[model samples]
Target: MLMPHPKDMRTLLSRYATARLAHAERQTLKSATQLDDVSYTLCVATATTEINDALAAADRILAQPPPAASSRP
Candidate 1:
């Protein structure tokens, strides 16, 4: 798949983080058993790491200038 622009990726990552937090909140409300709590915790941990990775990648991409186009036809 084609890579997304860093600015766009950052926006999308923010949305993803919001959605994940909402899901975690819903999961928390429904968690009545130990297994359910464990599952919710794992889900939250995974989401946190993935979101952090995406944010870091976007930051790295934004820190550099875009590559120059080749002059040759």
Candidate 2:
């Protein structure tokens, strides 16, 4: 059996994040049209909070140092 690669895992995670961000954007737009004053405000606030959290998480992941390569014979 073949082992999974770290780069492939990272690519999958990046794709998942992108998809989630798009979904959040769509929800924000949909809520803007359908929610009343208070509800809309709450929805917008929640969406903003989620976006900020996602950004921070992504930043932290990207900031991690790359793994050192092995030097084998």
Candidate 3:
């Protein structure tokens, strides 16, 4: 399985957080739509079917240390 880069995952997480809060506060169709979009993107990126599972997966990924830098002569 392929993994997303930490930076990309972070961006996705940010989008999810924003969308989640926006929908929670306003409860408008627009906010709901945005939340759905972000939720799907988050699921796809994390390779999980459920939002809760995807969130846990994301947390696991974020908790990991970044890859060591490569040195080339």
Q: All candidates' lDDT scores? A: 0.50, 0.44, 0.88
Q: Model 1, range 1-73, lDDT digits (tens) per residue?
A: 3345555555555555655566666755433343344434333433433535545655666676754555222
lDDT: worst 10-residue window of model 3:
64-73
Between candidates 1 and 3, name the one with more favorable lDDT: 3
On lDDT, the stronger of 2 and 3 is 3
RMSD of each: 9.2, 11.9, 3.0
Q: In candidate 2, how many Å is residue 51 off? A: 19
Error of 1 at 71 (Å): 15
Model 2 vs. true fold: TM: 0.35
Tens digit of lDDT per residue, candidate 2, span 1-73? 2222345335544555555566567767544444333333332433433544534444454566654566221
Better of 1 and 3 by TM-score: 3
Q: Sorted by lDDT, highest first, which candidate order results? A: 3, 1, 2
**Which stretches in model 3 have alpha-carbon errors above 4 Å?**
69-73
Enumerate residue pairs that collide in model 2.
none
lDDT of 3 by residue, 1-73 (tens): 6777778889999999999899989999999999999889889989999999989999998998886666211
